[model samples]
Target: MLHGQSNAWAIDYDNVYNDNNLPEDAHWVRTIGAMHVYNRPAMYPEAENTNWYVASGKAPDIRGGIQLVGNGMVGVLGLNIGLNLVASQNVPIAIINGAGGGGAIASYQKNDSGLNAAYGRLQHRLEASGLKLHIKAFIWNQGEGNAGDAVSDYKNALYQLYKNLSSDYTFEKFYLVQTPPGCSASSGHQTVREAQRQFAAEHLAVKIITRHGFPENPLFDGNYFLSDACHYHAHGYEMLAEWISNMAKYDFYNGTVDYQAPQLVRVIRESGKSLSIEFDKPIAVQPDLKVDGIVYSVKDQLFAINSKKIISISELKVDSKNNKILRITFKGKRLTKGAVITYVLGDTYPDTKEPYRGPWLVDADTGVGAVGFIKTID
Candidate 1:
């Protein structure tokens, strides 16, 4: 995972990972904060299966499924976990923190010239990498600068920024995180929140995650803040990180539909070795074979898999003792050498209003990751 840390956000990645007892796969790197303008410190990390690219003050070059963390407002650890999820899922993510505190949009900067410049530089570097990099999301968490100026064209700029960024990037998935609840001076904490909410409503791809209900421990308790009444203390940072983690984990898109099934399913086994698979009227997507959870996807939705290792179930014969079990005979070849043939079955939901059904099938050594079949036909 990668993150950015500056005056507003202090992230010690090693500390967070170590404290959490995370596995070694959770490798991460950090970017220096607001004053850092060069790319030297950011791009030097050794690339691994998952890479987190974070920016505190400016945007950095990122490709593949790498996540870019910016916006000085996101505390070090909060950004860390978000990066971790993106890395694990191998998806691209980008975070843009408006200049912090009293800044336009209620961040630190009265102007966003730094952010604008950073955006331009990041775009150029990404293009230079020869990778088809696309920006999919944006996270905003600033509003201190425009406290009273909420009445100004602040709303227009916010929307304009999204429009302009999206013009270059294709993905509409955007998230607006409200500024922390407490600001010492006159800040547009509430007004900006309203404006952000309004922006999200008007835009189909945009949504808002509220910080209005966040605890005000740092603002009220001097102990929770550093000498400066603006920044948070260690404990406060942890709380903020936890809040961001929750936001990252929230799934606005859960399109679970009622599954309907047909009758007369056929089973095709295509593995060189035979695998033992049982059929259930209402079978779990991926049954537990060993320990680790395996994720399978027919389309884009996440489904369970038995495991990564392929188990051998040889000389399998289909016997239809009951009229309900319909089995098909097929020639067996080799499955993937390392991978086993997991069960492929029709999905049946017991609670559906309509008759639920599907056919389960499997294929082996026909080809690499052979497509086996158990299709349901009415």
Candidate 2:
């Protein structure tokens, strides 16, 4: 099962660089808005009009089965990849896409409204499918809409959604795709990300895939977005599909999967020139780790650190008492009032192959790092 908002529904398979054909054994059903439900077999074409008006198996366009509607690329690719992996072991598979473009987490609660009113149409599809078939996993790729929501509210709402779905169906595992770093307008992304991190940590059956390094657009540079900087291109979807398929295979086969990211909890100043950076989990700091910062004249003001004098770290050590804390001492004048320090992970040593340039501080086991942090002196 697949569910989420626009990013989950956006499709750009036609623009994919390499050959990304659908699997022969895969089939899908989609709930369109509140009124229409379309079913399709595998190997559906991309040229057909993906609307209720189109008939299945029509010439010039194969209409039956799942058609790429709007920017709905990744869901189909992900499903194909998953089913292919399962079929390699002689297992037959089908998928249900119960997603709505622009759908928010709040809209899909037990009591629904808008396109999802009365528990929305997704529930209807799930109920109908649940009667005869058993669900394997619930793959969720949402949270872009909830980027502005309070962390607690988003967490609670997501938990409720999980509970409601579990009660309605029997699924072995739940996979959540961490929100992409596209929604910069919403300041609550970090909060939501933290909420997701915490929730996944507490739940054993839940797994989260990271979207840390995915480019907003693959074609051009200069902040080029896939589509409006929020959605992804076909290649992006394909990469996401690769992650989904791998996770699905592991979970389906009862294999243990890593689903944790290093979390930055706090940054405390121990002295005028020293600071203690804490993480929720233990981290392995690379020997090549470097720190570059600007001495801000005013606190809470954002500026281009490149133009200012760069402060170098005199010492960076792991706390012997607590592995989660990093003792950082910089060689400079004591930090005074109204001075701010900032450092971005992966900026100095960016890995083109890594996700988000690989987080600065990574877990020894998973190599996922805590989110970057900033400190402002009072």
Candidate 3:
């Protein structure tokens, strides 16, 4: 099952977008949806003939909700997952979307908001398919709604939500996609992100896949979308599904896949205007990394510091002697006392065009992208 907000349902969820990147056998694997965004197999007529018709469910009330008509539609995430599992594990599967957009973590809980009537919707879908007791896992992409909430509160609420969800369906594992950046409601984008990290760490069954590695396309065919910073395009959603399915394949069926990415674990202040970021593994710089809000300063704010600021990057590269520690040297002033750093640092990305913003690193050998982090220096 797929869960969470717009990022999960997909902002650019046009049938063309979904069909453009689907695997060959997607339609053969049956699928369905909760209420908000259900699946149809029009793309693969074979699947419709062999499986489900579009469910007669009510459309959700989201800012950009796709108006449904008699025409059929395909789920960008589900069919991709189905095809991947079939190709690799040789097992057929059906995916369900239980997610609704514009909802915070609290809203999706047992009895919080009407949107979570999705829980009831989910129950109905499963019963209709005769799989109320045969669910395997839940793949999710959320947290933007809870970005403004207190970190600790978000943590407990998300945990409770998980426990509550487990009560309704007997699913075994949970797959969480790390929420992408850009929440204008508050600057707490990183706060929600950190809380998600902690939640995944605390739960053994929950596996986290990073969305920051792919490209973020705010515009579809030259149209600018508000979802630019946070939501990804069809390609982005496709990669996310691929990651989730890959990890699920490895986790559930003992298939071997390299879905793990390099993670930032430590940060060190090297003497004089330099900082060293340590990753879990040796890092490889695939492209230039641009970060936001950098300044050189002294131990105290009272002291006069270098006036030059890092609006753009000076240089972000791996140190010659150390593959694990990426050394960054700022222009002009030395970084000292009271200084901090952040990632993808501006309102707009004027640099690279890769999906998601820069500051993206990866495992040197596997090329698996590194996880984008919170305000933490690493």
Candidate 4:
């Protein structure tokens, strides 16, 4: 299902998978791929298992066009992942060994480091290739390694990761896997989960996939997880994958946009003569409008109202219900009942949140204190 212009490659910094597991006759390794780069696992296994059969070597220098493979979690370190991502244009999807017993921190560290590095690489490449990379969604599930003091860092770590990804990816959309239940809501894992929610709330881009109300014993038994208490034994991973895929396929705001009322509304008056504006809440005009453009003289006033920009208002109506009025610039002007006037507002400049001023204005009505509407809006 990996559709692109490159072959799959496995880079293992964790030593989670080895050559013995992928010998010429080894089914899993051979079937997986031939390009494998094994690194010393940040934390190697206690008693070697069937999976850790590969040997570590001088890591390969991945240039580009390579896909990544690993166990479920990654997103901790920056360098290893950065390199992995640099080796490929397609965002790397890793599959790690799911049986490690380090609790939340272990999995989180590995998964987070890998994911973050990949994102960083994607950002750099997108910038160079003139391509825009956006995160449509995410699938995260980890909790075993987060049992103690290491737990406090979990939430912030995840939040920071999200912040970095959103900034680099230019898209904030993501999906969060709730920490599995039955681990006592007061546990460190639970603490991290709460932090995750707080982070999601502060940003408009993240959504938590509900693992709440999930039956414990009965459901686990019915779902085949009864055999393995820690990780998903039977159909859990499949079910989880299906759920994540469904969410990722659709817009994250599928049914949640209506609940959020617009908050920040602003207007830019290039000519400084416009005072008409709009926002989620009303705003007052500056007593004296002043906007400096590339080449222009004469100070003009501007205001944003109801998320719209208005110009040349003699005065404004005070609304206490909405603390909006800031200044009063338009007053004591000639009365032109319906005579049109023109004013300029801000312009959209890339990489800057600041709106630029445009001296040009269209047909706008003039009046002693008339509110001129925005003729052309960006």
Top candidate, metric lDDT: 3
lDDT of 2 at 193: 64
Arrange candidates by lDDT, highest first: which order?
A: 3, 2, 1, 4
User: Which candidate has the top score in TM-score?
Assistant: 3
lDDT of 3 by residue, 1-378 (tens): 777776666645343443445456555566553335332212222222223643211223244434421112235565567667888777777766666565777656666332226555555556667776778888767887776566688778888888877776777778777665555443435556666777887888776667655543445532223344555455666677777787777778886765755666776767566677787778776554333342221111111122222543355678788898787665654666445444332222334222234435666755556654443342
Cα deviation in Å at residue 338, candidate 2? 18
Model 1 scores a TM of 0.43
Q: Candidate 2 — what's its lDDT?
A: 0.50
Give a tens-digit lDDT track for model 4, residues 1-378.
110011112123234234353223222211011112222232222112123222221123233424223322221111122222323323332322222222333332323343133232223223433323643344344443453323247667776655654555554455555443323223223344445544555666665543321122234323323322333332333333333443443453242222121122333332333333333433332232222222322133233333334444554543456443222345434322233322222222122332222221111111011122222222
lDDT accuracy of residue 47 in candidate 3: 20
Off by over 4 Å in 4: 1-132, 149-152, 170-172, 182-188, 213-223, 252-378
Ten-residue region with minimum lDDT total, candidate 4: 1-10
Per-candidate count of clashing residue pairs (backbone under 3 Å)? 35, 13, 6, 65
Deviating ranges (above 4 Å) for candidate 1: 1-23, 28-78, 83-102, 105-116, 128-133, 215-225, 234-378
The residue ranges of model 2 lying beyond 4 angstroms of the native Cα positions read 13-20, 23-74, 80-84, 112-119, 131-133, 184-188, 215-224, 254-378
Indicate the worst ten consecutive residues by lDDT in candidate 3.
296-305
Number of colliding residue pairs in model 4: 65
